[model samples]
Target: MKGLLKSLLVLALLITSMSVAAERVHLGFTVHYTLKSSAFSAKLDRVVVTKVNQNSPAMRAGLFPGDVIELLNGSVVAGASARKLDAEMGAIRAGDTVKMTVLRSGKKVAISMVAGET
Candidate 1:
């Protein structure tokens, strides 16, 4: 009985650890954007941010709803889709710093944040 209890405790601890580790893989944020064609330039596209997740890295970095994300890690995200953004974010690991160039109320802003778990 003593050995069985010990084994069960170990298994439980392992399961909890695995769960925490799995949860830590995500960056803990959500974003919404609309693609728009530039009026001045026919071929230019824009990604306008509509929301920023609460308590997320985005929020921590001073990103808010209505902020337009222009670049990710210095790379342009003008025409990037949600899937593309996800791919970019997916490539980043926890504790990595994410640099962003954003447009807020017609003013350009730069921000950085350390990625963290959801």
Candidate 2:
């Protein structure tokens, strides 16, 4: 039947496309988890720290570019980058705690800090 043929083609494509996803995962080292939302967007992935702007919020918070954001809130950050953390931070505001998790030195840790402008 035509319907059965179409389903087989879809399955074949799905199986072949999985490799591309895996390659993307291997390209970078980042762990990001985004809560459900359609209005907000962010690209979160493992970042290698090559520099930390002088006197920047990141420096003040003791986080650098290499620090991988492994989790947001309590969820595992394993897919679909959306680290636009700085962009969406306005809602959180200054002096409010931004609960975050990170993968540092192969260890998973939770940390919280007052939200501040970059």
Candidate 3:
């Protein structure tokens, strides 16, 4: 009974998160996690930008493919779980300012853009 209740709660939260993701403001970009091997630590997940649509806020902000995402909305992206990342990203609404930090040419660059309609 307790297990069933917990499962239901998890399912409810998952559904809510998915709905938010489905309605999230468009960023005109796409990303995916890449495995990065470290010497001291275990493998790490790095969020890499795969594409940026033309004339989009992301493109205007200078985001480019091959850039590694370091931060989103001032939050660290290095160790965030995929679900948490999705929830945070999905929470953005149109006109909301989105801040990001990315690694390009081995240097960190900060960027800000307003979310747009999907």
Candidate 4:
């Protein structure tokens, strides 16, 4: 009986821990997004295009470094890193189609893209 109680307690704790360990998306500033139901959000930021790879897809797609990614795959690009963003950009490889929503010259621009080496 004691062992049974201990097992029940451990199972209860495990279930509680699993449920609470989930990460809920929160949008704070950087293009805030809120909704009635639980949602996930990513912040947006301005980035400078330092250089464009020679003969790469970005060049072909007419994307410059100064262009900022305001939205990625329909999610706000908050606290996103360049390396991590590749996946968000759709793991695009040469000849693969990708899309982007960006803010350039104070205007929202959307571009169809293919991934290329940086």
Top candidate by TM-score = 3
Taken over the whole model, the C-alpha lDDT of each candidate is 0.58, 0.41, 0.68, 0.44
lDDT of 3 by residue, 19-56 (tens): 34346466777765644435643232787887788888
Which sections of candidate 3 miss by over 4 Å? 1-24, 35-44
Superposed model 1: Cα runs more than 4 Å off? 1-28, 36-44, 80-84
What's model 1's lDDT at 66? 68
Number of backbone collisions per candidate: 0, 12, 0, 5
Lowest-lDDT window of 10 residues in candidate 4? 25-34
Q: C-alpha displacement of 89 in model 3, angstroms? A: 0.7
Per-residue alpha-carbon lDDT of candidate 1 for residues 1-118, written as tens digits (9 for 90 to 100)? 4553454344323211213434544433444433443553222155555456677776778977666779888878776544455456556666779898989878999989887754
Q: How do all the candidates rank in terms of lDDT, highest first?
A: 3, 1, 4, 2
Candidate 3 structure lDDT: 0.68
Model 2 poorest ten-residue lDDT run: 24-33
Model 1: what TM-score? 0.62
Off by over 4 Å in 4: 1-45, 79-90, 116-118
What's the lDDT for residue 58 in model 4? 48
lDDT of 1: 0.58
* TM-score head-to-head 1 vs 3, winner: 3
